[model samples]
Target: MTDQTKIRSGGRAARRAARAAPLPDHMRPVRAGLTGGAYRPLTADGMDRIHAAVLDALEQIGLADAPPSGVAYLTGAGASLGTDGRLRFPRTLIEDTIARANRSITLMGRDPAHDMELSGARVHYGTAGAAVHLVEVDGRTYRECGVQDLHDAARIADTLDNIHFLQRPMVCRDISDNLEMDLNTIYACCSGTTKHVGVSFTDPSYVAQAAEMLHMIAGGEDKWRARPFISNSNCFVVPPMKFATESCLVMEECIRHGIPVLLLSAGMAGATAPSTVAGAIVQALAECLAGLVYVNAVQPGHPAIFGTWPFGLDLRSGAMTGGSGEQALLTAGCAQMHKYYDLPGGAAAGIADSKLPDMQAGWEQMCSNVTAGLSGLNMVYEAAGMHASLLGFCHESLILGDDLIGQALRCVRGIEVTEETLALDQMRAVCMGGPGHYLGTEQTLGRMETDHVYPRLGDRTSPKEWSELGKPDLLAKATARKAEILSRRSAAAFDPALDKALRERFVIHLPR
Candidate 1:
């Protein structure tokens, strides 16, 4: 080879080696729990107005249809029962509960290594939703999601570095019984991935049996209480100042069993909530604030996430618009409210209104995910795999979402300004007697891993090189990665004996 060709080859080899080298957890460009809070869609005055409106809604409008137990819980904690049978929280009572709420919480993974500390503006993204269908990898068809599909999604999430945790994403449509479905949902998620799992019980009566199953998994009630890896994603309120009676009962039961709770208040903008975004946010906050009071009333300082998930609506057709810019503004606005209260918060984002993982899906998912991350949402739920306004889940989209979220998190990390980063010295070196460029410098090599995030499936190849490699696109690459991940047994799989015991105890539909 000519000397010039040899030099080029050696330079390429060194750059490739640098890219291959791993950095420590702190040094990596992105990971779980990066601080957000940078994008404030709500101004300070706007947030205050929303807060005041929320307070008024809780105190004056109140909520109807609380279970008797919930009435006792709230009334005992200084709330009043009106002649109209509505439960009302006093302004002071709500403020006091916020004062006593848990400021920070460590969401423990079944494996300690995956624990995420949620506080301040710390942001983490993960999969969530009870999507009923699996958007087939073919990208055009759908089928009822069985227990095996849920397990496979968890297994896939376990392998992806950017997917921080796995919530029960899809319903086990094959399971007919509610009790069996709830138990098996927990079993499938826990057994598939050691990451923290979230599940919701269908009925309050199911909680006892589910607790027993959880105890069996944790070795005992004490161990489970000490490090409860699972959280109850309870929708305590329906919408527009009303309690979901059955869900309230379930939340109370889950709290008694020492499981953490997500106070989810999902209202549609034009349907359940007011059509205006501000009005929708106020209602969501009011509903979640009531839930916060309910949880703290049951047990003070209990780990409850302020889940204010208000979705957007296409007013023209009354359809849910999960990917609209209005939805992004709503989520971002809610996140600012969470920061105002200094509470750990979660909200929905990254959903695709599009039925397929096409270019439309890409833009839709990225818009919400980027906005959520930038606004510092603590638990950005549905941050992956959701399609058709959250009716379907896709493995290929989930894999693609890992790359998407990686880029979003880089935006969350933002630009760090410091002496070294200013690069005055490096600039001086380059302009003086140096290489006339920053590439291949000592600083460049050192910052490569720390300063930039690389995508696993996103293609960056040039036209000629892309043609050489058979011209791959994002979907093709994601399909291959998903297949490769599912081809092997998961490293996070449960122990054989434990799996056997769980299967024997519960009607688990997933195969061993």
Candidate 2:
């Protein structure tokens, strides 16, 4: 070959290599902290109406059944205790709490590279729930969730790029005691994934012990304090204006113990909350604001996620309709309230009403995932692997959900109309000086990976090509991916010695 021929061949080889190379952190089409808020489901006037309703509910109707300490702390901080034993927060108190609440917080992964900032329109998706059953893919059967299953889910989540964090998504039904269950839940998840983990405590006393275990995993208490990788997913309230006393106490203890809290207010609309979408949002906001006040009262500027997850219910059947358009609207609306208060908040999304990972599940997952990201939620829990309306989780479904989340997050990124992105030169070259087409071009090759998202399981081939490739099955691909991910042992950043000590000290159920 001539020297010119060698040079041209070398250029082609370089371009091909670049195309095959992994995308850099900055170039990845979808990442952990993409700004959203392009799709606003609620208008300014609607938000104002909800805000007024929320404040009115807090000041007039108030919340009854505060744990004694919650009552004392809230009342001491300008909330008035009525003769009916209800704790009424003044509008002024709610405003002040919103102002003082920690707005920007980083949920640090044990791997710092995975850390995500919780502020503004930055969105992060993760798995979370209390599903008692596991969706067994092979047999298409439902079995009780166990500690090992929780660990395996975390491991699977760690391998999936779209899943930003791992909250305890299942209850360890095999464990009989509440305290042991809570402790093992923390151990199993944190051991399996270095991403920020969230767990709940049945009682306040477990908070300190869980924190100690977290400190062990984090190298030391001081290190854990500086970059706490764990958060308490505390459901601090019941619907219809009542506080879940034990959960509220657990929230306070979590705050004191240097752990972040997801102050969850999950009221099922048409049952626990008002049937109207607006009314459900009003109830959720009122309750989360109460949580906000409680957190700020306990420790001003404490890190707490405004978790206003108001679920939708099928009024006719009295069953939870987690994947309905109504649920999507509810979550998106709650996200708006979070932004309105200028507080870091989240709601549930990506839950499948279907029993399995089927066509129905795909639609359900995407609709809510897209809407939640666009609504600019800071944290979106239950963003993957949930099915049967939060009653079961599927490992294969989690893998599939990651692909769905990638597409959803790309939507969240929206359109960038920059000069380079406008591609006038590329267009001109193709139309005028190029082969009457832009098939092989510098700009196209350069922007391919950065500008587009490719799915791992989703097929995009023509019929002939698909048939040539053995007509791949998406679920089978997902099942293979799940097996591959779980086959590899988890490599959480804790030292072996620390892991040994943790296992020795705690009632750890999951085998290493």
Candidate 3:
């Protein structure tokens, strides 16, 4: 072989070694809680207007149909009940609640290492939503989601590097009983991953039984309260400025049991909410602020995520447009409001309007995920494995989404311009005295792992190389990876004795 051939082979080996090297958590290219308020879809004036509208909506219009207990919670906290039974928040009350709310809170994971510090523009991406069907790997077939599917999705999410948490993403359609389904959802998510899990209850009465299970898993109620890993994804509001009575009761119970709550206000644009983007954000913010008042009234500074999940709609069809650019703007705009209030907030993103994980799905998922992360959304939900506008969940799509989110996070990290990062000396070294390119420079080699994100399933090969190796399909690669991840016994699974006891106490539908 020629000397040039030897040099080329050696360079390739060095690059491989650099890519394989381990990075300290701080040095990694992307991670949870990277500051992101850089992309502001809403201007300062626009935000001021939205905030004013929110206050007006809460005070003048008010929210109707609050549960009896919710009425007490709000009224006790300076809110007044109208003769019409609608709850109106005093402007002073709203301002005071925001002043006393938890500005920064730690969302603990079952394993302490996975804890997320949600404050400011700190970003975390994870799975969420309640899809009823499982999209088969074939991309065309669908099946009703079972308890095992939920467990498998959690396990897959656990192994994914970019997915930060696992919320109950699908319903167990096989379970006929709502209470049983709720219990199994909790057991499946908790047992499948040590990461923070989010679940919802069908009724307020279910909270006591669920708390018992959580306490048992946590070794006691005290332990659970100290570092509560599970949070309640409570949809306390039914949207368009109204309370979901039963869900409000569940939120109350969860707060009483020391569980963190996601005060979700999912208003759809042009439908449940106003047609305009600004109007949608105003309504969502108003609803969540009311929830904040309720939570703080129950106990001062209870952990509640400002979940302003206003979605988009295809105006002509009246169907949900979860993947539209308008949807991205809505999520990003809501994130801006969260930052304006300096509150820990979450919103929906990474949803695919496409029915399958094809080209359409890729662009749609990346578009929203990028905007949401860049806008500094505190908790980015539905960031993976959602398709058909969140009606279907696919494991292969989730594996692929890990790769997609890795790239999105790199964008969120943005360009650093410190003295060392400016690289003037290195530029001088290469341009004046060296090889005239940055291929094998000392700085380039040093930053290979730290500055760049490498895809696990995405192929980046030359056409000739691809032809020689037999071109690989992205979906096919994801399928193989999904199989590999699910085949292994989850490290996060509960201890055998504990699992047996849990199975005996609660009718866990997931097979042992």
The superposed Cα distance between candidate 3 and the true structure at residue 493, in angstroms, equals: 0.8
TM-score of each model, paired residue for residue: 0.96, 0.98, 0.96
lDDT of 3 by residue, 306-374 (tens): 999999999999999999999999999999999999999999999998888999999999999999999
Q: How high is the lDDT of residue 451 in model 3? A: 91
- For candidate 3, the per-residue lDDT at 46 reads 93
Model 2: residue 104 alpha-carbon error in angstroms = 0.7
Estimate, for each residue in 1-512, the C-alpha lDDT of model 1 and write its tens digit.
99999998898788778778776788889999999989998888999999999999999999999999999989999999999999888999999988888889989898898898889999999999999999986647999999999998999999888899998899999999999999989988987899999999999999999999889888899999999999999999989789999999999999999999999999999899999999999999999999998998889888999999999999999888999999999999999999999999999999999998989999999999999999999999999999999999999999999999999999999999999999999999999999899988878987888898889888888999999988887787788887888899888777788888887877877777
1 or 2, greater by lDDT: 1
Q: Which model is ahead, 2 or 3, in terms of lDDT?
A: 3
Model 2, residue 233: C-alpha shift (Å): 0.7
Query: Looking at model 1, which ten-residue stretch has the lowest summed lDDT?
Result: 15-24
> Which candidate's lDDT is highest?
3
Clashes of 1: 0
| Per-candidate clashes, comma-separated | 0, 0, 0
Model 2 CA lDDT for position 219: 76
| Candidate 2 weakest ten by summed lDDT | 486-495
